[model samples]
Target: ILILFFVMMAQMVVLTLPRAAACLNRAQQVLEIEPSIVDGERTLDDGAREPQDEADAVAVFDHMSFRFDDADEDTLCDLSFACRRGQTTAIVGSTGSGKSTVAKLLLRFHDATKGSIRLNGVDLRELTQDEIRGRIAYVPQKAWLFSGTVASNLRFGNEGATEGDMLHALEVAQSTFVLDQPQGLDTPVAQGGTNFSGGQRQRLAIARALMKHADLYIFDDSFSALDFKTDAALRHALQGETRDAAVLIIAQRISTILHADQIVVLKDGEVVGLGTHGELMETCEVYRAIAESQMKGGE
Candidate 1:
């Protein structure tokens, strides 16, 4: 009788163990389902994006070199370049070749440890901070727009700017949708322009910068977001406007910078080549490699 009781107990334990495991599995599945959120929490903070570098420093760097404290070695070494009036100068390089460093120095964000930077023949170190940055307008690769109507954001760059000027800027930026929107200039743009497409955001940012009509335009990979057709049109617009003002363009695509009056190619903190597109093709292996890569990539 005792042996029969033990066999019955073992069969009951085996059957109950599987049932307990399956129950726990079902509980876990129910717990994983997300509860619907009835409403969002917290207030939305609408703020302007941080400005990079200085604006007014239409730049000239003479034998500049620098390194960050965290860096094991200098990021820029003996960098000498002059951005003059009425020409688009382009810089192209692979990552960490000190392309951004050059722009930073021009803006006086990081002063060159050794060398002199002059803005319009005036030494930048001597100029007041606001005086140096006031006349320059910049458009970064990561375009940002404040929470406001499209017209308001463009007007933010130059408060005195007119609706006609805003329309012209939008046109130059290769965007007609701003005019097509039912609200047109009155259409609201969310903070950071999150509601807009990437290309639209880029156009709005460009429109804002163009409204400033600044003496110097610093474009750091600004065209990287646009389609090829839009890019060509934007370039055409800029080309005509930039005849009297200096344009500095930093780009990775060979197609974008090929028509630049002067192209500066950097490799490891030094200029590997500098010249027109045709001149670079003949003399620069690095430029040739980039050109070939772009060709293969069909960008």
Candidate 2:
């Protein structure tokens, strides 16, 4: 246990991490802490407490690590993060920060080197990939669309999706421009959606993700291609429409995460700051610097 602690604890949350938006560290064994309250301020009214059992949490990363098939050094080092329903978690960092890797892990595209990832308390490795992934809708950095119409792309998120489903998703994404198009949903989309503009592609991708209305939604740098107005509008719609679902947004834009319930700052494959935006600005210097530089605001 001591050895595990030292190995997991030995790294900066800043620096020495991949430049990508979000990445999970490779954990050999994650520490397990029992439910106990060490300190709490007395209150006239009792505050709502989080469920004590780890199983109640939507997701848990217990000491995870990762590396490519041939890399000598680990791309991810001792990493841990959690997500829950009704919350929005944003992971932000420069390129090579392994931001995309977190999405991959959550989707079970790659297994961890040391620790375990649990969904609803079942070890991710033990759960069949299809079983675990059924609850998530993923939007990658590149919006992957099929060779079909906007409706087809949206319906792909869920096989049972109806015309009503596609219309609702398109509305949420502000993609009503489809109606003005020559053929609407029947308009042919090239393979991987190469024909659409970057912003259009991203919005379509978002609409598809929303269609699933999965328990979890993972967006990996999914909004970088969008213009500010579109981004803002999309976010506004997402907040209202997906109020009950957990959202994980990995982005390079600070403005995108300012309102997130939690902001995870990564540098060189480590978690340098973990808190709300204000909390990070006050307590994490590296995080402040990143925010200042990215947002062009006072530090």
Candidate 3:
């Protein structure tokens, strides 16, 4: 019995030691790295000549380029585009084409290595991180939810939101599944929303973002999980809710961006085409090929 006990103890140590070492190495890496993005010292004044009207609140990327600290080449290369308020701009590209990097730049996750990003005529570098991010509501490709009641997760978007606001957001997101739950707004969610289906989690994430009132809305392939019917309904509702805000979407599916005011196509980290769906189909071979491929798949 003593020999068996000793063998079990030795096996346990052998199993745990490598995991512990790897965890320590990761913690050490995190401790050693400095944050690449930091808030600017200056704050925008109330009368700073920024766009006062919602229609004028525009986001512009001018000759922007970004390279990760460890990467040898730029992830985004001389990308230029404008997302204007009251219009939808969709970025579509193959994987590794840097579509999502554009959203990160706008969110100021990393400052551009070259050129400038401007909001309402002011350079992003001149504004505090909070000042820039406060005006944008972002929904990432993966939906993230904390362990709490449904109402609590929705409140993260706007703490001041009332039950009425929560209900309205759910309605707009077409997330009526919550209403059928016995707990309704109070339904408990597990960490990372493991309790919900992928489509349900996405709808909840969209509802949470809809609860906030912001100048810009960024949906980074947020609808990839939904069925075609739900996707269409949610987008229809979103148009009404975000009529005055600039909407930027990064999508892999051509169907998701067909109705966008402008579609920007990326290839190998460069802007290969920029135009409406019909315009791109006629003028850009890359866009035409993508559309044709998707059309065949759908058929």
Candidate 4:
């Protein structure tokens, strides 16, 4: 009996050894990699401008362009736009048009290859990454939720948020479904929120972002999982909550951004059209074609 027990333990060790070694190797490889983005010497409080003249427009992208280190050419070219407080700026294009890359640039994932991106009249390069990210509330394309209670996840955005504040944010994000759960805010969330539907996860992620009072709010394809009615309602509620901040949305569906204050149309990593949806439909062949294609598909 003792021999058989020892043999079983040996078999288990042999089975686990390979996985343990592989995990260690991956960890070492990650530790060895040098970071491409480094912290700037300046903080947000150092040499910041008040934006007195352009108080409404908080973030300005000035002729910005980016090319990956191993890529053959630029991914985004000569992109210029302003995100104004109390207004929505939506970017739309076919896949690989670099709409998401714009968000990455703003998030400081990669430095721009050319031109400049400024926040509050200060260049992005001049600010520390932490400071830059602190001013922006971002909902990524993939709405990832940690394994915890719903209220705990929401508090990740604002550690000091009260229950009332969280409830308000959930309402703004159209995540009132949480209130229906057995434990409400205390409901357990499985890792990656696999327990919830895609739409529910997206709404919960939006609520998390809303908990933060940021100067800029970015939703990257966040409403794609929702139906039109819910999307419209969420946007309406969002407008009121974000009245004092700038909103940037990256979307593929035309209906999602149809009412944006400004619509930026991209093609082949370049800005092909910059105007409202109605204006783009009149003047931009690419925008008009895309709109027509989606409208026909819906029919």
TM-score of each: 0.78, 0.79, 0.87, 0.88
Against the reference, the lDDT scores of all candidates come to 0.79, 0.79, 0.90, 0.92
Candidate 4 deviant stretches above 4 angstroms: 1-32, 50-53, 296-299
TM-score of 3: 0.87
lDDT string, candidate 1, 1-299, tens digits: 99999999999999999999999999999999864312222111223121244232356777878877688887888777767667889999999898877777666676666777766655656555565556677887799999988988999888998888888888888878988889999999899999899989988888888888666788888888788988998999988766777899999888889789889999998888989999998899999889988887432
Instruction: Tell me the lDDT of model 3 at 285.
Output: 84
**Candidate 2 lDDT, tens digit per residue, 1-299?**
99887776665433445632233332312335432212123221234233467533567777788877788987877778888777899998878988899888888778877787777666666665666667788888988888988878887888898888888899998888877899987778999889988888888888888888677888888888888888888888888886777788998888888899998888877888889999999988877887888765643
Give the runs in model 3 whose Cα sits over 4 Å from its true position.
1-33, 50-57, 297-299
Best by TM-score: 4
Rank by lDDT, descending? 4, 3, 1, 2
Q: Which window of ten consecutive residues has the lowest lDDT sum in model 3?
A: 46-55
TM-score of 1: 0.78
